[model samples]
Target chain A: MQPYPITAMALCNGMGDSTAAVLAALRAGRSGLGPCPAEFELDAVVGAVPGPLPPLPGSLERVRDTRQTRIAAVALAELQAPLARACARWGADRVGVVLGTSTGGIEASEGAYAHAHAHGGALPSHYDVERSHALDAVLHLARVFGGGLAGPAYVVSTACSSSAKVFASAQRLLAAGLCDAVLVGGVDSLCRLTVRGFAGLEVLSSAPCRPFSRERAGINIGEGAALLLVERTGEGPARLLGVGESSDAYHMTSPHPEGLGARLAMERALQLAGLVAADVDHVNAHGTGTRQNDSMESQAIRAVFAGAPAPAVVATKGYTGHMLGAAGATEVAFVVDAIAGGYLPASVGADPLDEALGVDVVTARREQRTRAALSNSFAFGGSNCSVLVGGPA
Target chain B: MSAPGFSVRGLGFWAPGYPDLAAWQARPDACPEDQSATPKAELLPPMMRRRTSLLTRMAAEVAAQALRAGGLDPTGATLVYGSVYGEIRTTLDLLAALLVAGEPLSPTKFHNSVHNTAAGYVSIATGSRAGNAALSAGRSTLAMGLLECAALVAAGEGDVVLVIAEEPLPEPLAAGRRWGPFAAAFALAAPASSDMPATTCRLEQGPNDKSLAPARPAPAWLADNPCAAALALVDALAAGAPARVALEPHLAAGWHCGLGAGA
Candidate 1:
């Protein structure tokens, strides 16, 4: 199996004003979630970063929507230095950009729609296809990094697993010799539409989410962005060991009762890596804290590991909430950090493991060396993806 | 990169105004107002038909047609549904419900609003207990779906794979008169015999300087070209030789697909 190299750094917003904040959050096992004000009509808990998110520069604001574009812009800014250095080292024209996002600029469009209905005018001339759809984030980021000159720019919006699939796409592109370096990540922000949409699904938990716990409820919606720089070079920060993607083709909203798709995805990833289940040091489960999802994933883990000692399991939704399409990429950043730091952060709200679940849940932070970790991202419509990441061999 | 091409075992389509390829090619008069045809309802069951968006109904109908055309059952067939803007009308409705009624949105509508909703609905309707995938690539929706279909077949996951591409009516705000609504489908399987025609499609870096050796314009450029380009390929294969069809470049990459008769 060919290995895809991770040649640069990963960045997020809540990791402490900077990359150090992310390190601090990991070391202290702190969650970035906080209460969202009533203005957003959101009563459930949110994993929102504290502080004012300044609007995008007027130049960029002229062409795009606000809410998500701001988050995408900030995420790009956070990784600018590392990305620029990587580009300089690998040639700017060799790098491509791919982003995973569900709600590209919908929040802004919703506002524009309301304005058009009330004022009876055009939808702010800037609401073009490049600005309103999911691809806008990718295009905007490409322009920011001068990668439009390099290769194609794409955005994947396969629900929650959107970003995780970007890693798979990047790997395939590299394997196909499409590009030498790629920017793969996901970004999503709090929007009334997403919040209300999930709320309508009756899966939003008012209290903090408890993943893998018998008493756990539903998930808390969060908003953030994460980006990883990838290249084909052998030497780098980490390597993408393998990626597995599958669609359950089961129910639209519900997972398979036996977690067939989840099991297939994990097994495929393991097979692609030529590693057994025991080789996986830790698993970042797609434990959304929802009743069906948590149980389904647990069943899949047990089916894969069987009688062997299950890998240490950690759920980051307690910290970052569920970022939907962005959840996969954001969680992968945590997995990369776990390998770099040699420890598994506790699942913040997970207390007692559900007796029905057959795997060990890491409730409290533990220090242990991990060579590799598997990150899982499951979406609505039964889209499932698992990515395996490991340290330098 | 030299993976063997899949066999084109069968083909099908469901489109506005036209229920089958014959009816579609007849070029019936367009609707006076929106020029959109009333979707054919007879293709799906009543229970599975309720509240389905134009995209879902079109995708399922086309997918089923492909399976039937191939003389294969929908059961256990791997599905790959590709679309650019998925169920836009339903998405608009959800947003409207949030703003006006402040009413809790319907879970059904919310689920269908996702890009992969059509793939899931097809699975449920066909009772397909196998792999399902939904992908989106501007202009390359069909190509992407075909790529995955070929890969899955190559990986030995299925005997045949169904690749379906459908685009919902462009809302006034979204499409701005750019492209119209259409759905196309093809059933691909591992080559059964060496004599069958073979085709290889790939996404390549753009601006090829090579002179056009009888290059065909993208399907979108062909006037009144709905469901015809797919049929054209079928015709081209029957009159076997080598032919290349250039799809509109997506993501700034030049993409040209080659189809040829093979031994």
Candidate 2:
């Protein structure tokens, strides 16, 4: 798999609403997590984009207006000019959009359902699940927005690994010649369904997350979006070098204790990149902060690197909270910044790293020249995807 | 833009009346009005079985049948699941619990609410370490799923199982849905090693060749089912005849599928 150039990208998380702001936050070693919103009864930390996201451009109201879409709109707005230029350079049909999402406006249903329950199961006349809860709503929004891209479009919804896997899918489409350029993204917004769901799972931490720490408690869920435009053309920050994926076949909600699936995903990613374990310069760990997840991920990293001074590992979830489906693509943005900008963001909240885990989880930001980095995203259902991004060929 | 095609190794279909290929072929267009009986996911052990939702159960049933029918190792193939309204019943259940006062959300239901739940259960049941994906393209689900399956096989991801399903929406949420409950699975492999005669499938750019997608075998004008588009191709596979199948439910997606000898 030859490297594909990432031409343009846009993303917003609790850390910041733009990539520049996010990078600035990373460079400053700031955390975006805060006390959970009062509206939600859950007692936990969260990473929510600041209030009042721009609404969908008017005409799309009937079929694609959603809080998730509004979150996506922020990213889409940032790329409008470049995206439109790509559409012009390559015919609209020659561009494709593939998004990854877990909570697709399910909040739309939450509000509607609340109204329905109060009114004896009668949903408001204005409610439209097809438009709002369409799990692929963000895909449609991307397709229609930014001057209308009419191409092969779809969505991947494999929990946290969803967006990371998009690189591979987009690569396939490009290699198979379905589209010349592809807009790959991940979109998910704060919703009671996700917050309450994590609470129900008993994996919600009342305090900020501490990845790979001895006192690690659980996850602080977040909402965010990341969009990257890839082309056969050059002149971008990084290249998507390789992608690898695997299933744990172990449990529904738990990862394999040995992290065999996670290890396979990393090794396979290296194999696809025409490199070995030694070629990896940095690692952006999933590091969900849950006891089981952090412990198992460390084991997997230790297994792969297998030497003193493994790759510099930073768990960004400590900063962004577990953004669910959007974590993968958003992390790739950080990896790209690490490679091109020559910096490694610290694993915020992981001050006293868990030495027993045996993987060096970096706790301080540093200026370092990184050539290639592997971003790991593992999800419930034991789904794992590892993506490698390189500085230049 | 026509894709390099693959071979169909086996097929699986399930619905209220038609539970298997044999049943489907017996009455190729039998969309039974009485939607009563459900798919029994026998491959899942009781413990795993008890935790699954109807949508997951339906997906497991068809995926197992296809893998077994193809004479391929059930755990050996990569999986691609395409569904618009995935794990809907589980989502509804979670929402109901969350909306109720004083009732805590169910952990099991929350775990089951992920769109990839079905793909995960199937892979876990078969003990497969291969990668699996759950995706959707709205009305173009089956077509997009086929594209993914073809790409995985082409990329040497291994043999592939492409499953398209959508469970019937219950009550208040029904208005947003246009499809009925059904599931379909197609087991696929890379083309022959040499120039040997075999059934093939190629997705091309054009208006669909509607001649191949026969009217679905349903009692009345039933709503479209996610799996409904594959009926014609399944029949052609059963009879070893050449046919061009329309993978998209609607005709205007600008993609065409050919399935049969040299198709």
Candidate 3:
């Protein structure tokens, strides 16, 4: 497959709202984990976006005005200029939108549930189920930028791997001459269902998450959105070289014991890029900080790049918590920023790396000119996606 | 907007009236639709059969029908599942548990509630290792799935098994909406394949006003449920002619899928 250019990107996560702010925090190895502030009954730390989301403009007044859509609106606003430029470069009909999400406007539904419970099971009039549909984010973006996109607009919702898989579909669309450019990203907002659900499963860490550490506990749920404009003929700072996807087919929740699916996805990604494991300079792992996830990911990494100098293994979840469906694209944006700035962000929370894993876990910021990087996102239901990004060779 | 290198080789559908392609072709003008009862699918293993929801079963049944029609191996075909509303029953169950009892969601419900639950179950049942994608785009779902599947086949990825489905929302959540459950599947293959069905088709984006509507007055379910729009495509295919379906109210153009004379 041919590489596609990443022309522009916008991010809003726990560490910061802009690329500059997030890069600064990363270079300083700052942890964005803080006390749980969303009033969930579960006791756990989280990486929530600070401050209120910027209000949606009047143009999008008809769309559902939920927290998730508002967060997506912020990212969409940032990409407006470049998106418009792309629309001019290629007619609006040639530009598409592909977004990923797990729980879309679910918090709105939860709020409605709360209201209904308080009033003897009578729901509020404004509580429409379509507002909470998983496709809300896509509709919100489409409604916001009504005439700018007229191709392949949809939402991919495969739990956490949702966004990363968007790259695969985008590549196919471009390679098959379906669309000239695409607006691809992911958005997920905090909701009681996810937080409480993870807590019941005993995977929500009460303390800050620590990936790849001997004492690593579990994940910290977070919320945010990440958007990028990918085109076939743009002079962008980074390129999506290849994407590999696979399903675990083992357990619905727990990953394959041997990380079989994860390993296959990485190997397939490297193969598609026509590069050896040694060509990768950095690894952005889906280290959810859970004991099972960290352990399985470590084994998978070791197996994929066996006998080669290991890439700088780092996990950004500690800085932004796990953004669920949005994690893949958010982490990809974070890695692209690191590559452009010529530094490798450290894995902030993991200390005293687990000796059993045999992986080089980055613990401190390092100044290195990274040429190619790999990002992994493994979701529930055993879905795994790996994306390779790099600058011009 | 031309899908120059792709073709739709097979099609399958399931709903209140239609059970599969053969049954539908046998009686296209049956009134009030078939309303035949959907039997328990024996294709899946016991565990999966038990775990599978009615919605998932509808999708898988149609997918199997298409795959059989195309004579393609499930393991070699990429799966793309599209939906308007996904697993509404499970979603309502989970929400009720959370709001009424303040209890954690059951692991089964949690897994089943994901949009890709049907894709997961299909892969497990057939042992498919190929890539899979599950997506949603409201009423344009079937059109979007057709576009995506065409792209995949045009890229020479592999044969694609595309499934689109929707079930009615819980009465409270549904309010006055009258849509019911429906699912459709298609086996889309690249041009000139030996196993290809007679209906070799390609999709192109064309004038918006050229968009198609149901030939007859649509049933309440067909009018409201997005996935049911797939029946329009089936209707056109059964007529052995070229047709287009409007993805409007969303996109600027409708999809024009044409079948070759062999169809």
Candidate 4:
């Protein structure tokens, strides 16, 4: 349960392109979601990354070129210098890659389907399904393109909790001495499948999402990528103390009614981190703004810190939207910002907090020393993961 | 370099031609078209049973068999699932629906498309709250999956059921590799005293020469099946011999696994 150093980090999402930019926007109280375009044929607001994405370089285009890889390339480029230094420190063969994704470059498949229709049900030969749409798309992108990491490498795809679970895998690899350093990341880009799929489920909000508010609507889906370098000998101002995982064993797409799995994951994370409820300074919630998720998460937070004054809980989805697979890593980036900047971002858009919820939903920034924080990301099939982060001891 | 050692308490296998390890070992070289009663899936309730994809049913069936063989309790075990592509049948259906107008994509299919659908369903059916992980590494999937199982054992997770599955790939997506549906599960734990046969397993980073090849040649019909790599280890266990098996022959470098006698 010893803390691992976050030696280097790169983040690109609706909030901002770099960790610093994201932190700045968090401090300034800004919303990154905008109205969804008519082409999407959806009414909800979305967190689409603006501007151009860097193209895949050279032979990577043959197997790893896609919207997901392009989005990951943006963040991986920001992480180049530090990542390269770490990879050099530990030979490429000694570093591992564990990436999480919900729908890996699925936009390519959508295009392929349209192309198949035009060509009488023949998919375009130029596309590589394994490289682009499979769960390992980003794993190959980061391993092969992220300096050819040759150690243990794999991809985790458990819906929304996809990327957050990567940290657990990294922890195990480092704990087992399989790698000196591991690059753990998550990347999911917007595609017709998810946008329309959620629409069919009636969980897409026409207006900006409002987490934990009585008047809350559903989620505003987002797209982006976040990567972090964690080392066994990690020493720095930031640290990943622990990761706790659990399954609801209840339902797919729906959380346990009483937040049972969420509470278990948080309790397990606390156990791993060697911390008590009172030690936590803040909680970055998996507040997807869905009525079910917010209520369930609130119940879990209150239960985890029962009898003690629960820490300030903030939902930054208003800033980053719901990045789905990328939410965990990106929101954890927000926690790093808080640890370094000595302040907490208010739960943006959480106005007139829902009375039934029993947790402190921070409505304004509070400048304070945040020594430890917990970040929650739960996904379909009741897959739950909670990561503990804090300033160096 | 060898990692910490674990033991395989039980093993299970399912494929188009071979329904179980006994059948596979009996006729490894024969390509049988005999229709066996594919999994009855008695554990799954009626409503949930209707939603399972072929991949999920295949995995759950093998998982149940492994647990029964190992005489292990599902409550105390963790589930580790690996697949090159997960729930492709459900995903393809979702994609096709997306291409049409007015008709909404089936929410059930969309939810079932997750790579971990099998783990989730099996966990629920078995009442396993021990947690689960779903992963993939393309050709290196089985190797990475076994490594994860070893790591979990070393991390004090007690017992783990490692399930590796791959449903048949559709055209263009197959990319010219003619692999059929395959799924396998092995219940593993720390070396313990028991009357049942067990294979001592350790993951090592070394050359491929030490790897064991199945005594019976694999049927030529199914080629490049990811889960097929585990057959060598299963064969070593069936033979009750100490040997090294190549989890992945060509892709993941130095994934030579050693199996031997165990309690």
- Which candidate ranks first by DockQ, i.e. highest? 2
Q: Is candidate 2 or candidate 3 better by lDDT?
A: 2
Q: RMSD for each model, in Å, please?
A: 4.0, 2.0, 2.5, 2.1
Cα lDDT over the full model 2: 0.82
Encode model 3's per-residue lDDT on A240-319: one tens digit a residue: 99999888777778888788889989988888889889989899999999989988998899999897788889899989
Q: Give the local distance difference test score of model 3.
A: 0.78
Error of 4 at A123 (Å): 2.0
Cα lDDT tens digits, model 4, B212-260, are 4444445565556756676666777777677777777764356867777
Which regions of candidate 1 deviate over 4 angstroms?
A13-18, A37-39, A57-63, A81-94, A134-137, B1-9, B22-45, B67-78, B129-131, B140-172, B175-179, B188-241, B249-253, B261-263
Off by over 4 Å in 3: A39-42, A58-62, A117-122, A132-134, A142-147, B27-39, B100-102, B208-217, B245-252, B261-263
**Could you give candidate 2's per-residue lDDT for residues B223-257 as a string of tens digits?**
46554666555666777666666666476656667
Is model 1 an incorrect, acceptable, medium or high docking prediction? acceptable
- What TM-score number comes out for model 1? 0.87
lDDT (0-100) at residue A369 of candidate 4? 78
Grade the docking of candidate 4.
medium
lDDT score of residue A110 within candidate 3: 76
Candidates 1 and 3 compared: the better one by DockQ is 3
lDDT of each: 0.69, 0.82, 0.78, 0.81
Scanning candidate 2 chain A in windows of ten residues, the lowest lDDT window is: A57-66
Per-residue accuracy of model 1 over A267-346 as CA lDDT, tens digit each: 88888789888888889999999889989999998898885667999998888889887899888888887887788999
- Candidate 2 per-residue lDDT, tens place, A1-393, comes to 778899899989888888788778888899999877676666668998876677666687435666788889889988998889999998888888888998688978887877887887787775677778877777777876757897778899998999999888988887777778899979888888888878778888889999988888999998889999998776898999889899999998899998999999999899988988888889999999998988888889889998635889989988889999899999998888888779898899887878898887789988888888899999878899999898876
Model 1 sits at a Cα RMSD from the real structure of 4.0
Q: Across all candidates, what is each one's fraction of true contacts kept?
A: 0.38, 0.69, 0.50, 0.63
Candidate 2 residue runs with Cα over 4 Å from true position:
A307-309, B31-34, B176-179, B193-198, B209-222
